[model samples]
Target: MSEYKFLTGLTSGFTPVIDAGFSLEDYRHIDLSVQNEILSQAQLDAPEAFQKYLDNFLLAQGGQIPWGGYNEHRGLYRRSGLFSAATEEDLIRNIHIGLDVWAPVGTGVLAVLDGRIHSFKDNNNFGDYGPTIILEHEFEAGKFYTLYGHLQRESLKDLQAGEKVKQGERIAALGDASENGNYAPHLHFQIIHDLQGKEGDYPGVANRKELEFYLSNCPDPNLLLKMN
Candidate 1:
């Protein structure tokens, strides 16, 4: 069995930007739990409000919503698995493999542990994350990696592959909607134990069929973030 450490300090120590003219604390007070409950109970309960949320998210990114959800398989994005002809034709399709912490643009992103830059890329697409970075760390008993997506372009200006990064190092900054692949500004953080022959990017989420493999390779980031 693997012993996990609670990454509480890092999650609590960072000050996250919540929204325009607001802080993360303020944004967290928006009663997302109630909203989620209402959404679960009846989609019609707050249709207009929900639409407004989507609109605001789209406006922030300066792009339209992608054909499907990038973080998870359920909710609004899963209604149509037919995002594109290519995706529809694929044997294995969209699966989210990360934890998305929605916040405002320009939020600071910090490294959770000491590591080296594994790989990175500017995966810009209508629904894709803008600037993404992955770090590889080898522990005493095993090797693992952490990925940060939807980062600002400037964050990558100074980083390079194989560069050493310290724990708690400011790795990147959150990108605005326009620069962050046209989605609401948020950090998609994932823990990847195996690359599974993938580089530059891996599935941030997975479909039900592939859930077992992904879950084994990608453990809960909250083990490191302790945000919950």
Candidate 2:
């Protein structure tokens, strides 16, 4: 196989990092259901402070945070071991490796570039990414993979491994909370340079110690979507 194309010819604009020049206050009032979940779960009582932290974090990570008033605190829970007893395995599992774009159910999710369907499956479980799809793209000197999680069932109806997909194709649609493994509707976009012996499911998040490996394998997806 050719060294896969690292990055080229991707475009952005459909997804704005800051809600089309709207202020933080404006995002707060967008009336989306997921915003309520963010406010309640993330405890984002202070919008300005939260937004500042989110912006700074994304900038440092080489990606742009998506708009829509949802702030993703990657590695926070993993670092604190809030999900369970602080075990090495548990910690290694919670660090999120993808950029989650908060949006409503039924949102149209387009493919970032031309590629072949590498694999896909229905991952039904609590706190899991529901239905998912992974595409393998070949570029000039490199090959890469993109994973889309929490997608509606319709998205997977006719897709299959080795199927060809065009750039900007409507590969999948957003799933609702109930069908999306019990979380709010959102797109968990991830890039993987190496599958690392796993299939059907990849680490949507990781722990502190495993950060280096996950980050290296899963580069900032904004490189393709430019949705930030």
User: What Cα-based lDDT does every candidate model obtain?
Assistant: 0.61, 0.61
User: What tens digits encode model 1's per-residue C-alpha lDDT throughout 1-228?
Assistant: 153443333345433321223332332212222224544423312434444564564465554321122235434333333322234323344556676666546767877788999989887765566789999988765777888888999988977899998876778888986777655567778888888766667767465566777777787676665432
- Report model 1's TM-score to 2 decimal places: 0.68
TM-scores for the candidates: 0.68, 0.68
Q: Write the per-residue lDDT of candidate 2 for residues 125-218, one digit (tens) a residue.
A: 6667789999888876578788888999888897778999877667788887667765546677888888976666787766566677777777
* Clashing residue pairs, backbone N/CA/C < 3 A, model 1: 61-177, 95-205, 95-206, 96-204, 96-205, 96-206, 97-204, 97-205
Provide the lowest-lDDT 10-residue window in model 1.
Answer: 24-33
Once fitted onto the true fold, the runs of candidate 1 whose alpha carbons sit more than 4 angstroms away are 1-73, 76-95
